[model samples]
Every structure is written in structure tokens, then in C-alpha cells.
Target: MSEGVSIFAVGDPAGAQLNAAIRRTLFVLGEERSEVWNGVLQAANALRWRRMTQPQPRQFQTQQPLIDDIVRQAKRLRNLVSDGALLDLIAEAAVAVGETDSPAGAVLLQSIEEVGTDGCVVVASKAAARAGLASWLDEIGATVLVPSELDTVASTAETSYVVAPPSFMPSSVVTAPMTPEVTFVMPAWFGNRSLPSSAFGGHAEGQIVIKSTVHTIGDTTEPETAVAEGKEVADVYFPQPVWGTRSSGEREPTSDEVEACKVLLAGGLGLWLDDGDRIRSLDPKQPEGARVGYEAVKGIVPGTYLVLRQGETERGAMYDRAVIALGARARGILATQARWKARLDERLQLIGSRRAMTELERLGVRSSGQVRAWADPRLICPQRDADFALLLDWIGEPSHPTYGNAITLRRAVYKASADLRKELESAVGRADLRALERDGILHLDLPREGFRGMIVARVLAKAPFTEIVSRHHVRVPFTDGSAQWLD
Candidate 1:
């Protein structure tokens, strides 16, 4: 127990974009490969296993099965409103839309304004009757502004925008064409000129020039330009507020009472056999190296990513053993788990020939998770080595060293064969490998109906995961990129 609590302020494990970018950039930095590393892994073992595995009823996710769950429900609400169920629900809520002019549409407008609402913008076509729309807007207590027909909206436009880096007291993105009409709510300290000329700013044709900035946190703001030229657009965003006190390692711990807390870590908090079965508590001494591993594990979940929790030291993070393999797999402890998703995304120009991807999309699989389930797809789809590689190349590199390299189909085959042969050398090993393969692994084969299908990719690494496998009943169809540890 150090005298005082270890109060290293922690922040969210950056978004996939930044994470992917850093991992990809770092790897290429050493090798001088400007090209981005793709984020997919083709799991040979998983594919092979899927082929021979028996059908077992898989559990269905009960919470929400698809990303469109909300959208679908919202659409249902529209129908319900017409059918007359909406008036009944809203009648009891004590709220009115457009009042003398409230319509269900106006009600939806209000509902969408709440924090954390999956937001959408409503644009009405010209003949859509302004009176009814205004009636709807008034019912919803919304101010109706004439939208520019020629204006466009974009999520990312890096060509000429400059944003304050993520590291700042209050980070902000700058834009051009700042004006008073644009009611943008930004941090209080932010200045009109605080934005550099490079801030990604552009005009919506003849309507107005717009720029945007997101708050560090919570709902607070500094003065902002309400309008530019003539357009009446408001800035939309949630501000994540910052709070927490800082502490140092050297803070007073020499006192007697302070040292007593240290006793709790003596095998009292049960050890976490982190990735590679390295006792996380052992390396408390090297918070630096352990920190790298710490970050890898943390990416798995919010806090358990630690080698050991609280003040416990990491004991044997050096070994190749793992703790809670499948759970970690779900949390992303596998090499695929450690990747920086942003970098691979950059290379993924979304500009390739989509014929093949389109075909898969038509079938249903859209995400890597869904793709993993397509190894042994329905149509006995022939080899997709090259196509899959192209798709993988665009997803960006993950930080875990295990992902992205030569297709490794040939090498994986040889390695798989060798491993099989060696296992057969020890009959016990053969039986075990065969049994596990017969159990199951996942695959994906679609990008479109991904809402309905799967796409396939595989992660192949040589490791005696059976030990970890024995501990958990779940099978994680992925691998830790570290052959040294997993092996």
C-alpha cells in the first residue's frame, strides 16, 4: 500500500479512429510504410472448426438485436400515430405539440431534442405544406427555420479544417466563415478567433459559412456566433464535462496507517491471470511496460483490463498465459481486440470496386463480427482470398501486433498441418484439437444484409490455448497476435 491512494487520472480509451490511427502509424513509423495496416484477421482454425462443428442452438441477444432497433421503433411510432395509438400515449404525458397547431410530427421533434437521443434532422420537400409543418413544429415547441435546399451536410471534411488536438483543457475544432447568426454553443473560454483559419470551414453555397465544435463534456458553453450572413442554423452536440482531482505517486505514504492498506493485496483480492497468464500484480514495479499491457487489457473492458486491480502488483505478466480467455475475447483482449480501428479505416477508402462487397452486402453481413460467422457460408462460396484481403486492408490496423500481414493462407495451412501432425504425435493432443474444432468457431460472409448475414475472416496464431480453454466453457474464435505468448 503506497502511503496515499494512486490517483492517476484516467480517461476514456480513445475512440476507434484515433486508436486505429496511432497503432497503424506507429507500426509504419518504424518500418516507414506509409500504407495503412488493415484491421481484419482470417482465422483458419475457426473456419476449419465451423466446417466440422455440429449445430448447437445459439443464444439470441435479447436486449436489442440490431443497430436499427431504435429506427425501426421510431418508424412504428409514425404508423401508430396515424392509427391513433400516439394520441393516447402523448395525451397522458401532459405535453402539446404545435398547440392550436400540434401534430404527431411536432411531438417527434420534441422527443428528438432530449440528450443522448439518436438524432436525425428532418428536411421537408417543397410541396410539403409549410402551414402543416409549422403546425407540427409548434406542437413540438420547435422553431421552424427555412432550410437551404442547396446546403449539404458532411461528417468529416479534413481538407481545410483544424481542430484543437484531443489533449487540451477544453478541446475545440475551428472553422471558417464565423458569423453571429450561427448559434453555436462552445466552451466559455473559446474565442471567435480561437479557431484558426484552417478550421475546416466551408460555405453552404450562398446560404452561409459554418463551423462546428464539440464540448469537452456536459452541457455548458461559451458565447458563440448565432448566425453567419443569413442562415439560421444552430450547433448541435453534447458536451462531455471534465472533472477529477490529480494525484502523484510520490504523495505521502511513509506514515504507519497509510502502509496498512498494502496488506489487502497479499493474495487477498484473488489474482487475475491476464493475457499470457502474467500475474498483473507482479509488474506494478514497471507500470510503464505493464501499462502497455494494461492498455491492451483495458481495451477489453472499462477497468478489469488491469493486470491486477487496486494496488495489487502484476506478478508474472511475462508468461504467455491468459486470464478469462473467452470473456477477454468478448472484451477484445485478443490481438484483434488490441487494434487501432482508425488507421485501417483510412486505407478503407470506401472507394474500391464494390462488386464483391456489394454481393456480400446483398446477402446481409456488414460488420467484422458478422463477417466472422461466414467462414462456411451457405453457397459454398469459392475462395475469396484477394477480395477479403482488400476489404481487410481498408479497416485499418489494430494495435495488437497479431493482425495484418501477408494473407498467410499458405503459411497458416502449413502451420495448421504441422500442428495437427504434432498433436497426432501425442495422441492426447490430437483428440483435444479435433474435439475443439468439432465444437465450433465463428465466421462472416456478408456486408449488406449483414443485418441478416455474415462475412468471414480468420485469425491464425499458434498457441496452446487448451489450458485457458479448459478453464472457460466459451470458445473465442480469435487469437492473441502474440505467437510467443499464445504459443
Candidate 2:
């Protein structure tokens, strides 16, 4: 109260990534080595965590480690469009494929555009009418574009040439010159690039240049020219938006209100308990038949006392608290009487993972409320040690439930662990983080007493959020390079 109302904002915690990195570092250094080189290891671990939190792209002159392995995987998984690689391809295409007039090309580009390249992309082969590929695309929620309707297939080229990332095509597809026409030309790496093509295999060759894999149809003379001329392609990504609510504290009371509260709080509304436990009123006009003077003391007060409302004063707040408690008890009793407990339990059962729910039931926990008691975030992510396997085994087994829900809850925990790991490993962009922080501040509805004029005006002047202040609406954008509105 003395400090007045202070307004501060915060977001979701950020230690998960750092924590995971520390664990990894500890694992990498054996216990004996870790203890001996603890100081050096700790510094290195911190540096690694910082690097992960604030990621940047490296301009390597040659292929980095495992670049070949990555290319191999991409090639294996490319044509298997349903294997969660289409989205990445679509993203690359949107950023790389500038403008094309061909209908089939337009359609292919439009598919990525409609979803906005930030999300997953669905694609079908335009060269040959492959039912298997079409069905697979459909199963995986991607749209297949056919080239026949476009008449864009070249006269000399029997197969329509579509450009995709090299990583997404098979080695055979990458090396194949033309089945009458080159079916597709892929950037040796997982990307989209302008590639030369010929119908009769005059000068077509697939080459891995520098760090990327490229498939070409026409010239093998300067394969390196396939790389973008002016602008460098970067792999750096931004952080996700982190918005949170902020509330200000209450205002300080005036001297008059303080005095009033004191009077009202005295034995509560002029009713005091006697030695015999009898309730007595202080108004001094008790009627003959009235237990407490309801109508006897009506008209004599003239600014000599206080007026208390349940919402505004201590004495009235006491009664309010009693009423709320009674109401809660009554509601609980009514719910039990009406046999609604089972329905409520059924409702709780629908939250969280299905497998977790099943496991909880096996361990005699069937309700949402019960699940929370056992779902401690710490236990979900146990500490690492030589007994790590034993601990994990114990956690995986239902018979030895350390925590109430421990036996039934490893997959959900594991999935959460994996997600946190991925988030930690990924690069978070500064722009996205700034936008989210600014938006969260704008979203706040500060109490008049706590707003502190300078702060509000400063925020409004800085961000683009002021335009929509009247609407009280906001949209958080995705951190992906593609233009996308997350929510």
C-alpha cells in the first residue's frame, strides 16, 4: 500500500532450454571428468546455451559436418511427400520461386501461397499421373497439381519439369536426365533455384556444389552459378511470441475511508457477542419482538457513523465471505445430490493425452483433478544420474508408482520433453520476441492509479499496436520467414 500500485509484466519462463543444455553437457563429460573440469565445463555449457538462445547463421566456404548425411536423408524422404517434408519444401519454394506465368507453375505456387509458406505444404506430381503418389498426397493432406490442363509441358519435353529441393527427391530422380522430359530439377540442397534444362539430355547433370545438392537439365559447365547471386540464403530463425497478462495493484485508501473501515470492522456492523454467546446490537432501539433490530432504529443517524457496503468495507466483506463460503458449500452439496460428480469426472477425463488418461485409470486416477496432482513438471522430467535408466524404468512401470500418476505418465512426459528440447535447439528470432513482449504490454488493462502516464505514452509511440488499441484486438505472427499470422 505504501509503495502504491506497481505494474509489472512477465512471460512464460525461459530456463527449460538452458537446463536441457546443462544436462547434455553433463552427460557429455563423464562424472569423474565433469568433477575435475567442472569450471571449464560450466563456462562451455553457458556459452553453448547462449549460442542456442541467440542463434545466427554461419557462412561456411565448404560442406559442414554431416552435410552429406542430411542430403541423403532429404533425398530419401523427398518423394515420400507425406513424410512431413513438404512443408519445408513449400517454405523454400515460396521464398525462392519469384514469378511464373505457366498455369501448372502458378497452381503449384498458389498451393503454398494459400496456406502461407509458414505452414505445411501439400503437393502432387505434375509429370506422370501416378495414382499411388496422388493417394499418398491425399492421405497426407497435400494437394497434387497436374500439368496436363495447363498445356505448359514443353513439346520436346514429354514429362513436365518441376523444380523442387534436391533433398526431397530420390538419387535416381536426381540423376535421371529425362523420361522424354526431365520430370523435376531439384536444388542439390533442400531449396528452390533457377536451373537450366534440355529435352534430349544435351547438357543435364546433377551436382553437389559447395554445401548444396543441385539437379540440372541443361548445363554442367558452371553448376555453382545455381546459387543465388546477390542475397545469401540464411538458416537463422526467430523466436515464438510470448504474450502474458499483466495487472496492477489496488489504490491506497484515503484517511476518511481508513477511519470508516476501522469503525465498521469493530465487532462487525455493531453486533457484538456477549458472555452467554448472545448477539447484541449497538444502535440502542431494539424492539420488543425483534431479535436484532431490523426496523426499530430507522431515522436518527446524522453523519455520526459509517455506511458499509459488502464490496467496499471490512465489516461487510466479512458477511460477503460467509455468504460465498455458504454458497460454495450449497453448490457442492447440490452437485452431489443431483449426481453430477460422475459427469464432471467424465469431463476431466477428456483433458491431456489419451494414453496418459488410460494409464492414469489403470493406476486408479480417472479425473482431471486427480491427474494434475500427479503431473508435477519436475517429476515429468526426472534428474539424470547413473540410476537414470532405473529411474526411467520405475517411471515407465505402473506397479511402482512413486508419484500418484507416475506409473501411467511417461509418453506425455517424453513428448513434452521432446518439444522442450526442440524449442531449445531451434533459433528464436529477436523480432518475434520483441513483438510478443510489446503486444503483451499493449494487451494489459492497467488500473488508472498504476498506469504511470509516461509508460503508456511511451509504449503507444513505439509500437504499431496503437492502431488497434480501440479494437482491443491483436494477431501474433509466426516466427518463420514466411508471412503468416499465428493467431
Candidate 3:
């Protein structure tokens, strides 16, 4: 490979000096260096910059951890700096710069040693310039220039190195050399302008760019070749499931359900058991004794039982809260209290008082007066005043006392609707209805009970019948079926 100079643009001055010292020590030892040097440089830059930017006493305190890291790295490299006096001087200078409160002058002095055999032109920052480190550097045969004197530097000359802050390093310093080698020592609070792509030879092939902040080596050649080869390998061997087949009882989801499930996943909603072990322990008799909970729809396994709230009374306090938690986006779908009352009155008128009372009695209504009130449009319906759970039991179609599958629940919803499929589509979108064809499925995204209950309500309203007969042990039917369930 052709010789190319490496540039280290560290965020902190002390960190830059430390990195230069480590790289120089590695070079002197004549051991494999670039990888180890680049790793340490990136880590040091990040830690130093973070420490400098942190609030108050934190920024002021000594970075003993960073010092420890540098010592540990040196030890890992067989303590190479101890082998030579020049390396020892560089190491001591690096430590002194890092531990000091004001490091600009110490860092600038340290940079003089990093100049190669051909020497370098140094551009001093305002702080380093005021510290009078330039005269010492110049005396050592290094051409030191202030930021204002950047234009005077002989850019056209084949210099070994050009060391400066990213802001002061001129275009001529980069493009003027046949194989330009530059090092930028960045400030703690430099403004938004980043080093140009040209500084790294437009990420050209064979160019190795080391950045301290991200700790990544941009090897332009290898990565592109790897990506191109990867595409060919993937084409030859399509991805397949690594695990065993799905359980016999699980049903594969239709394409429509998959699309709807995607939406539910995006919304972060899923079905959960209303009366799990934790919830049931809260209360045994009162329906409100326990709160409802939900799991992510994507996580529901084949055997899990999901809660289905079947109440049609839309104006309940709990129901209102649930609708509100669906977010303002659902305002168009959720009906108002007045609209609900009118719809209920019209239903009662169509059924007639006698038949309505008979249906209420069959649903287990004991009070004759309550039955009469609900049956008659003129009288206030008992449903208007009933508790949320009690209202569902009185008027809503009773769920299968044992089974909790989506197919069974959907059938119940279809039976309850006036126009069957038409009303079901109106209440729940057709796309969503198709999603309900599976067994024991529920989805929820929000943790709040209101949000959880809203998802349950939407599911109950839109559930559609499926041709699949089995419920228990039914595996989820997807193209990529696996035994492992997502938590």
C-alpha cells in the first residue's frame, strides 16, 4: 500500500495530545499500531469532550478515570513508552496536559514532538497563542503560525504534516500537497461547522479516516465489497425459519388480519385478560373490583384468554374515558351521548315495549319496573343508569361462558347488530373486521386503563367470523411461523 499520513481530529486539546503520544509510542515500538491507536484516540476524545461540557464541579474536577484509561492502555501495549526517553517525554507531557486545569499551552508544546522528519506548520488557537507556546515550537525547528498567519504558510510545499484547529485549517493546506496529511485539534465548544468530506479525500477508496468522536474507521474499499457480495449471497439463499413448525391448534392469520395487526402494532395496542391472577385477587364479586390490563397484540400466544366487553350502552363514564383515550383522532368514529340515547330510543320503538320487556326478562332482569322502563321509549331506560358491567349482562348477548376465542366473540357481535355485516363494518372498519378472524386475539398500546379499554371495545365491535373451526392449541398462522413467542 502507498504511504498515507493518518489524521486525528480530536474534540479536546488534551485528548488530542494524549492520542498523538500513544500513536507515536506505537510507531517507535514497531508493533502493529493503527487499530489500537485509533480505538484509544476515539474513546479518549469522547470522554474528554463529555467531561469538558458537563456542569460545574464535574468539569472542574480531575479526570482520574481518563488518566487510568491511558495508563491501562499503555500497560496493555507492554509499557512501550518506557523503552525510549523521547516516548517517556511524550507520555509525561500527555499526562500533564490531561491533568492540568489549563491545558492549551501544554497541548501545543506536545504537538511540536509529533512533527515528522520533514517538519510541520502549526496553526495556534487564540488561547494557545496567548500562552506563548508558539515561540518554543518555532525554536525547535517547527514552523508555528497563529490562526491569522495561516495564509503565509507555504501550502504548496510537500510538508509532512499540517496541524491546526478545524476552523483555521485552510483549503490550500489540504489540496496543495500531492498526498495531503492533516491533523485537526478541535475546540471544546466549536460551532456547528463540521470538517469537510474533502478532508478525508471524499471517503475515497484506499483512504483510511479515523474519527475520535464516533470511534469508527472508514475503510472505503472493504465495506463496499462486503455489501455487494452480501446481496448476491442473500439472493441465492432466501431466509427461512430457524425453528420448528407451529403448534397444531394455532390458525394462520389471513393477509387482511396481518395488515390490521401491523396497524395495531404501530398503535402499540394488544389484547389482555381482564381477570388475570393479579386482577382477580383484587375482588371476587364486584366487576369493578379489579381493573383491566392488556398485552401487546404481537405477544399474544395461542392459548391466552382475552377479555371481551360486549355492552352497547355507549354513554357510560368508563366508556367515555375509553373513547377519549383513543386520542382526538377518533372523534369522528365515537358517537356523542345525545346520539347514543336517540339510537337506543329508536331501537326500543322498533322492537315494541312488550317484546323488549320479554327480551330483558330473558336476559335475567328481575325488577319488573326496570324491565318496563328499558322496554318503553317514553320512560328512561335502566341501561342509562346501570353500572358498565351490569349493563352488558342485562342487554348484551351473553358470551360463551367458557370459550374466549375471537371467532365466537365475533359471532356474538354479529348477532347483536341490527344489519349484521353492514353495521359491523360501520362500527369497525372492514380492514379491522378481517383482522378479528383469529382466536383469542387482543391488542393494546397504551398503559392507561382508558386506552386499554378503548382497544377492547373496538375489537369487540369489529370482530368477524372465520372458517377456522378449532380454538385451543391453535398456532398463529403467518408465513414465518415459529414456536417462540414474543414477550
Candidate 4:
């Protein structure tokens, strides 16, 4: 669409030859008019006519030629087409007949020679095909097979690769009697996918074949130190147990607690605390004032201690009002319960000494009925002038003549009541107090901690081992701090 960019030029012999090869290969594969063929033509045309606006200085220039771009695009095309063998043949033909005088082309040719054609079959899912995996295998000279055709050809094929989305069952795909290696390709920000060893084969150990050259999105290089490092990967791709504990002391978490954590994570809510400080630092947007205190789930080694906030259950519609009333009643009952009990105990002690009745008579001659009423824990009443005077005299506090002023007493009680109510409401509103009391507020002293501070963390931290919503590849971090894109 830009200046100097056009369809494949007609006059250039090398470009013409490359275009002819592509056309012939597509035709042989019955894909000449397919989207794959169109995409290839557009990619090749774009690269072949890509012109540099200005010549770089001699020192800055690197030996990147049109052939290299052709190969790169060819590899990417594997995901677009179903027939990788033909696509690879087309790419090889293009490289062989196209311009190759550049030093980079010479090196590429030599590398291709070293990686001699070794015949292997690749069975890829539709999702993997869209991710360009088939093309990549084809570029490496592997015969890519559709799932249906695998049953017919698998017995005779040597070394089969089964590539599928993380949620797929590898055993189900390769039902025929042949040893197959599996690779899970997952995309960015995907959730609810897990890779269990059981999927490979029951009881028998299956080899995990990892390709070092294939890189996916959000991948980073491995660190070269012994110290722990955090490499953020897509939440769904992180393969590690959710670390948690029941108490602040160091202890292992029970299976039920772990499952609860998984539920909380699935619901996309929970608190994540850093290991050292026990502070909420899961937010990436927050400024880095502390040293690296959080380790990714995949990088957590056994014996490391971590802190975590407990997960909350789904509350009923009346939860808020019920908690408020509970908190208010608790405050009122607790405030007087201890004082009332102490007063009763003291009265009993005095009665044993035959001084309680004398003291009661001195304080306005209280009868047995009055004593019984005052001692009742369930009797909640407003402070009256007589009661206030009696309490002051009984407690040996000097009574003031103006103590019963109506406005003063009203204002004092109103302020005290308001303050107490506010304090209780704030405490109850911040967290589910009932849940916290029933199922401890936080889990501490575990090996690893995850912050449910953001949506991504919640989806990943304790996601269940269930079917994936979508398919793609992601960079996975290991316990040793090394990482690679598992595609």
C-alpha cells in the first residue's frame, strides 16, 4: 500500500521463479486459491519489494537478505496451512532458486545442510495449526499429518510429535499403538488449562520433548545466578501448586485448604502477600520500594515460607446487614458483661462477710428485688439519676451535684454510642469477619505466595486443572529460574 511496495514484480527472474515455485506447490497441495496461498503471496511480495529508504553506514549494515525473510515467513505460514510438507517444499525451492549470493544465505544453506532431512510425522490440533506449528515442523522437514490420517499412518511412522492445546488429552489423540511425545501450545492470558503427567500415558513415564528454537510470545532468557528471580509469564501457563498455610507458624497446608484456595482463585478474589514483609505487593503498577520478595509460582522451591490471605466464600444477600447487627450486639454485650460479672462477684464476697446488706441499705436501701434486677445480665437499661448516684457511691467515686443535667447526660451518651458504633462498623465492613473467624483470616509460612491483587493473578494463582477456554503457547518459568516458551 505504500510507495515502492507492489505485487510480485514481473521482470525479476529470481522473484518470478520463487512465485512459480509457490504456485506449483500450492496447486499440488490443492491450496492454490486458499487463504494460505494468498497469505504466502502477500508475504513474499511484501518482502521481495521491501525497499530501504536510506542506505545505512557500512558499520551499521547487517547481512539480512530477502531469502532470510522468505524462510521466516515460510516458517510462520506452517500455522496457516494444513499441508506443511508441501509448504516446506515450496520454501526450500524458493531458497534454492532465489538470490543467494549474500553471506547470510550461505550460512543459512550450511545450517540446512547440517540439519539433514530426518523423516518424522507431526499430528497437530486445529488450534496448533492456527498458531503456525505445522509450518515450523514442516520447515524442519517433518511430515505433518491431520488427526484423522494419523490412525492410518502412525504404525509405520518413526518418532511422532503430538501438538495440541494445553487442555487437550494427549492419550485421546494418539489412541494407536505408537510412542508419541506431547507438547502443549497455549496463548497469552489464557486460563483453566493444566498439563498433568497422566495425560502423557498412564503409569508409564512419557518423555517431554522440548524444542529450544521455537519461541512464543512473553518468553524471556534464563538467568545465570543462584538467587531467585521472577519472570512473569501468562497466568495460565505457570505450573506450580498454590502455596498456603493455616497459621502464621511454618506448616504444610491440607488438601482441603488447597482446594479452597483454588476455588478462591477461580472466583478471581484473594489477597497475595510478599514472603519477607507479609505485605500486599502483587500489584505490578506499584512502585518498587522493596527488594524482590515475591517468587513466581513456577519458581517456588520447597521449604520457602510465604504468607497469604484466606479465600472468602460467596455470601448471601443479607450478609452485610447480618454482620452489622452481629458486630453491634457483640460490642454492647461484651462491654458490660465483664463489669457486671465483677460487680456480682464482689457483692457475693461482701454478703459472705455480712456487709453487703448494710452497704446496700446505705446506698438508698435497695431491697432483694432491686439486687436481683441489677444482677441480671440480660437487663439492659439507660442510666438514670438514681442509678448513676448509686453506682458512684458504691464504687467510692465522688458524686457531682450537676451529674444528672439532662442535656449533658444526653450529649455524653450520644457521643459515646456514636463512637463505638463507628468503630465496630469500620472493622466489620473491611473484611468478612465471620468467614475470617471460621476459616482463618490468612495463611502464612508457606513456600510461595501469589497476589490476587489484579485480575490476571486471580485467574492464574489457583486456577483449577480444567479445560482451557482457548489455545496458545506461553513462556513457562521453572523452579531453577530458567524459562522457555512451551509451544
Residues 120-146, model 4: lDDT tens digits: 454554321312333233455655554
Better of 1 and 2 by TM-score: 2
lDDT of 2 by residue, 391-420 (tens): 223234322223223322334334433432
Judge candidate 4 at residue 57 and give its lDDT.
22
The whole-model lDDT of each prediction reads 0.23, 0.26, 0.33, 0.33
Q: What is the C-alpha RMSD of each candidate to the true structure, in Å?
A: 26.9, 29.0, 24.2, 26.5
Q: CA shift at 241, candidate 4, in angstroms?
A: 23
Off by over 4 Å in 1: 1-198, 202-242, 249-487
Q: Write the per-residue lDDT of candidate 3 for residues 383-483, one digit (tens) a residue.
A: 22232124334344233321122222223333332122232222333223212222113333333333233222222111122132222112212211111
lDDT of 1 by residue, 1-487 (tens): 1121111111111111112222222232344322211111111111111111101111211111111322233344444333233222222111111011212222233333641122222322111122223333344443322233213323221111111121221211222211111222222222222322322324344443323333333222221221222333221111111111223233322111110100001111212222321111111123232221223221232112122212212121111122222233333333342242223322223432233345446544343222321221111111344434433444543322323322222233334334322322333222222122211111222222111121111111212211112111112112222211000
Model 4 pairs in collision: 78-135, 79-132, 185-472, 186-472, 186-473, 187-472, 187-473, 272-451, 306-446
**Residue 245: error of model 3 in Å?**
32
Ranking by TM-score: 3, 2, 4, 1
Candidate 3 positional error at 93, Å:
4.3
**In model 4, which runs have C-alpha deviations exceeding 4 angstroms?**
1-118, 125-131, 135-141, 146-149, 154-156, 162-169, 172-234, 238-487
